[model samples]
Target: MNAFMKVQNLHKIYGDKVVLNKINFDLKEGEFLSVLGPSGCGKTTLLKLLIGIESQTSGKILLKGNDISQLNSSKRNMGIVFQNYALFPNMTVLQNIEYALKFHETYKKDARKIALEVLEQVGLTEHMNKRVDRLSGGQQQRIAIARTLALKPDVILFDEPLSALDAANRLTMRQEIKRIQKEYHSTIIYITHDQEEAFTMSDRIMVMSEGHVEQLDTPLNIYNHPKNDFVNDFVVKHLQTKLNDLEKCMVKDYD
Candidate 1:
């Protein structure tokens, strides 16, 4: 079977500055892949291109073997959860999620059913009547996810969805996201600067540095053996704590 999605020779430029350079990768069906990088490394730019939020300067983005690089965001059948959760403050949680079905076929019959189903999946069934602004950050994020999943898109793009949350909220949202992904078996491309976040929840990680793909591999391999100097240095700081713990395990404490 072929990959569920393929990016070929992708490049994006802005005037004289290049933001993405000859990027390439394949995402398998139901795979959870995280794009990890520092700010301005083109991680968000890449996600934009993937979801058709921004047109690429050059290259092809193929979904299920058809070119979708030039397709409009709505026509791409891809869902995105923005960093801020992008919920409508004026709407209640159920209304926020049900809004995604407006133009969809499901809008005619039982839109409320689909919306409630997704709310239950995200553990927010009871809070459906509450306005999003009144909820905590983690709850808001779940509503964002419920809205996206209600559409049942072929692929999901998360653009630093937890970045705006506090440390506790971030941790809670992370586990919630992992649970939802596992339950739905959705193909997801998550973008984040947090190494622990990427390592904890991804099947594979694509490490980017200044518009280039430094490495693409499983989290364990990326942690134990980075592909290049950039990757090694990038992961070293995050790996130190794990390395120290392992070393301490070898030397039993006499307490």
Candidate 2:
């Protein structure tokens, strides 16, 4: 079966520099996957390419088997939540989310109503009237997510969405994200440099390095049985500790 979302031979270059070189990957429908790598590893560039924020030098990005490489960002229907939340500081929480719906001709008329429902989904109903600056980082991130969900896009791309939050809040949001993804049955591609974050939230983690894919597999397999030295050295050195931490976070969701 073909993947619900696919990237084939993706490459990006700027003058003399190559950012994403011959990249290839895919996502099954409703699957939550992460592209894990360190800073400057081209993960963010890959996100940009996938979303059409920047066109690839050469490659194909297909959504449901249709080539969407040439489509603009808005046409792709891939929503993104940036690390900084990207909320309009002047807008209220409700307004920030409703702003996204205004661009979708179908939802433009019902923007406010749909925004309220999505806010409730993210557990932010009470803060609906709050100014964007008044909310906490976690709350703001939820607003970003709510804004994205309001679009009802084909795929959601999270560009290191949790990296800006404090550790405790990051843990909380991790579980919340998993719950929300399940609730929406959404297909997602999460970009992160933190192995623990990727391992904690993803069904599978794609390890990347210097514009190359090192390995792609379940977290346990990538951690316990790394396919290469970079995978072992960069992602597997902690082993049991990450597993313990991962289990503890999952357990916290029920507590």
Candidate 3:
């Protein structure tokens, strides 16, 4: 597993308040890493910094071993899917996907071809000609994903991408996103507050508190072996009560 993205001593501040403090992590190629935390825990801020939407106050970001801290959003070759889907209301499904490729200039002549292919990948080929507003929320989200995929970016950042959907829709989209990432072999950084979603979708989960990373590990370890009291209380919400005799004896001793 090659390191596709790296963050070193990442820090962000607003006025006199620090939002992120000396954060560090590395994402492997073709890996799906989820940032999970409560609201205002800097999960979204970390995603923004990865995609170049927000600059870090200090530290470095490396993409494929190249420093990208100073690179503009478009130059970073990263795609981002926002929580709201961010589809172009005036453009058809095909046109929306093609927009990302327009930066290549040659895309103008072959936009439809590229767009249709991406739409088909996301199971939206039948809706290629339909206006974005005509599609359902789930369909629009697929369109947004297709548009980002069309760019063939090195990394994709998802900023609570499924937060807007209903329970059923969220479940459906979660599977779709997993499928798309596997098919494309794309490195994905997904941010979410939903523990179930993180557990189900992430190759690994990074648990954040306030502005710092408490633990970064596989989902099972994160749930069963949290690093501190905060992680224990915040991340691990439930545990099995099937105690063995020894454990029951320990409880009796405490009592």
Residue 33 lDDT, candidate 3, scale 0-100:
96
Q: Write the per-residue lDDT of candidate 1 for residues 1-255, one digit (tens) a residue.
A: 888999999999999999999999999989999999999999999999999878999999999999998989989999999998888999999999888697687563778989988888888988999999999988998999989998889999999999999989999988998899989999999999988899989999999999999999999988888888888878766577777987788776733
23-59 per-residue lDDT for model 2 (tens digits): 9888999999999999999999999999999999999
Off by over 4 Å in 3: 238-255
lDDT of 3 by residue, 43-92 (tens): 98888888888899999999888999989988898989999988889988
Off by over 4 Å in 2: 240-255
Report clash pairs, candidate 3: none
Pairs clashing within candidate 2? none
Going through the candidates in the order shown, the clash numbers are 0, 0, 0
**Residue 173 alpha-carbon offset, candidate 3, angstroms:** 0.6
Q: Cα deviation of 19 in candidate 2 (Å)?
A: 1.3
Q: What is the lDDT of candidate 1?
A: 0.91
